[model samples]
Target: MRREWQVFRVATTYVGTVVGAGFASGQETLRFFAAYGRFGLAGVAVATALFCLFGITVMELGRRLRARTHREVLDHACGPRLGRVMDVAITFFLSATLTVMVAGGGAIFAQQFGAPYALGTLVTALLTGATILAGMRGIMAANSIVVPLLTTAVVFLVATSLHDLGVGPAFSQLAPHPALAPARSWWMAALLYVSYNLALSISVLGPLGAEVGNRRVLLWGGTLGGLTLGLMAAGMTLTVGAHLPEAAVEIPMLYLSRSHSQVVQWFYALILWAEIYTTAVACAYGFAGRLGQLWRYREAVVATICLALAGSGFGFSQLLAFFYPLFGLVALVVLAGLMRRSWRLGS
Candidate 1:
């Protein structure tokens, strides 16, 4: 019973780490999957399989290597020279992702509440800076509560949308919005989606894996986490597909929830904001921690938050479309190296 509980906790954390601002906002889903129409769901399926395969592989390697950071796992998977290259790339990507999250924060505020975008951006930056200065305890606590709420919110929105549209009609409603899609095809979108998320998640997952007691826990945790993410993605894809043009926004889920009721809108908005906050903190911490005394701790974190706020002006969708795919391409190299290493280990 205790072991099972531990597995669940690990799974929850894994899901939380990946379920960031872009994910909860529904923009990422819309861009990667929903834009493909019904084929998007198939893309979600492909992403699910990849998420499970790589999620477990990463944790398993971390256990074997006793990795304290993603750097260690990268070293074993890519060899020293390539590993150093990846380290710099992923670290830079982490900071860029923080900027994306900040932009997402502003979008949620402006789109959902009609608030000033800069107000939202500054609020998110302040909260993230505080959490980082205080330490990881706040992040863990926030994730514990927010991850479950996010899952429930996604399920609720999907079910409500389907109920309104009816099954056959909803299924028929899906149409490819290629202009909104980040990739050229459904398969490419799915691969890029998983690659970028895995790249971001390894910062937390690698260390978590090293701390776990055994391989069994890592296997179960990774499987459960990957499946949970798939379920959420599928739900978001269906809901957004049913709603079409309305889903074409910076905060699609929040907008969809508002069409149902003000209460639902507020509930989803708060949940989304919380997720955005947690993800921003994780990215800021990872970036600053990696920098290691180029400046004082407070100075480093504050500087990061300020940089992200400045970057947020580019707009959420634009930043996400540009940065995420680029990071995904880099991460794909890391994934290929991991697969080669895994095959050799098997042999």
Candidate 2:
């Protein structure tokens, strides 16, 4: 029972961490799955399967190697030369992802509460930096409290929105693009989405799996994490599909929740902030860990926080649009290489 609960906690944490600002805001689904139209449902299914399968692979690999950090697990998974490439790609993605989260948090604060974006970004960066500096225990402790609250709030929002939303129209909006109709390929988008998220998540999940000390725990954790993400993706799609035009203002989740109730709106805001903390902590920890390996410069590590804050303060939407797809492609290449290696090993 204790072990099972631990697995649940780990899974929730993993899900909560990866979902972050974009997933909660509905932008991630818009960019990845929702872009597919009705075929987007097919994309969601493919993404779910990849999340489960690759998520398991990542956790199992971590458990087998008893990795203390992503570097060890990635090194084993990709080999030394390719691992170096993976490491650089992951580090870059993490930094960019953190920037996105910080920027998203700022946008949420500004739009939801009339707070200045600069003030919100600065406050979020400082708070998240403090959490990261406290280390893994701090992260786990914070998530223990925040994850459940966020999950509950999201569930409530979904339930309330579903009561009012028309399913027929939502489905109609999801039709595939006419230009891409000939390709008959929803699989690529799904694969790309999962590959990208998993790449960013590996830094957190790999170390988390190693910590659990049990394959069962890792498997269950990964399963829970994947399912949670898929559910969020579906919910975001449904909500956004129902009211596509209203989502143009950025932070679609906020709009969805506000339409339901003021309480729901406030809850969503709090949850969004929590999601920001999760991503920010994960990214900062990963960055610090990587820098500790490459340069051993503590001052440089602190400076990275300032850099992230400044970059994010400029504009969240622009940063997200620029970084996510590019990183998605890089993640696909890394995953393809991993799959090839796994195939050879199996043979």
Candidate 3:
């Protein structure tokens, strides 16, 4: 039972690490999947498969390497030269994830709650900074608590939306919103979406994998996590489909929840912030961790938070629209490297 519980915990953390502000806000789903209409759900399937495959590989590699940080995992996969190059690239991408989360908080405040963007940015920074300061255990604890709420909120929204629209009619409502889509086709969107998230998640997975007991725990935890993420994406995609008009907004899911009731809107808004906070913590910690133990802990963290806050000036959608696909390209390189290394090792 204890062993099973641990695996569950690992799965929750993995899901939490990947399902950040972008995912919860409905921004990412809208960009990657919802914009393509019904075909996007097929993209969700593609992403789900990749998420499981890479999630397992990353965790298992972390266990083998006993890696304290994502840097080691990259070094092992790409070897010294190319690994160093990709390491720098991933570190920057993770930092961008932090920036994106910060921007997301501001968007939630502005778009969902009608609050000042600066106020939202400040609150997000403080909360995320506190969590990162608490270290890896802190990120794990936050995920364990927050991810469940996020899951519940998503399920509630999906159910309510489905009740209103019916699955067939709901999907029938979907139309190509090319302006919001990350890619022209669903398959391309799926690859970009998974690549982008895996880039952000390896930071947490790298260390968590090291602490995991065995292959069963790693495989089960990863499969569960990936599936959970895919489920949430599908749920949000349905909600977005039902509310096609609202799908163009920054936080489409929140807009759908609001259509149901004010109470539901308030609930999801809070949950959205929690999602942002957790992902911000992951990104910040990952960025600092990737520095290779060369910087002072307190200073590095504080500086990283400040830089992220500054980067939030990019605004939520602009950053998400541009940086995510760009980083996805870089992550594709890392993913390719990992696959080649795994093939050579015959494991």
Query: Candidate 2 has what TM-score?
Result: 0.89
lDDT for model 2, please: 0.74
| Candidate 3 C-alpha lDDT tens digits along 1-347 | 47788788889989989998778888788888888888988988889988888888888888888988888888887788888888788888888888988988988888778999988988998888888788877888899899999999999888987988898888888887888776778898898788778867888897888877477888899999999999989888877866776567767777777676788888889999889888888888888775538788877888888898999998987887778788887888778767776554334
How do these models rank on lDDT, best leading?
Answer: 3, 1, 2
Top-TM-score structure, candidate number: 3
Q: lDDT of model 3 at residue 211?
A: 79
Runs of candidate 3 with Cα error greater than 4 angstroms are: 110-115, 342-346
N/CA/C clash count, model 1: 0
Candidate 3 has an lDDT of: 0.84
Tens-place lDDT per residue, model 1, 88-171, is: 998888889999889988887897789999999999989888887865555656677788898998999888888888878987
> Global lDDT for candidate 1?
0.83
Candidate lDDT values, in order: 0.83, 0.74, 0.84
Q: Flag clash pairs in model 3.
A: none
Better of 1 and 2 by TM-score: 1
List the candidates' TM-scores in order. 0.91, 0.89, 0.93
Where is model 1 poorest over a 10-residue stretch in terms of lDDT?
134-143
Error of 2 at 52 (Å): 1.1
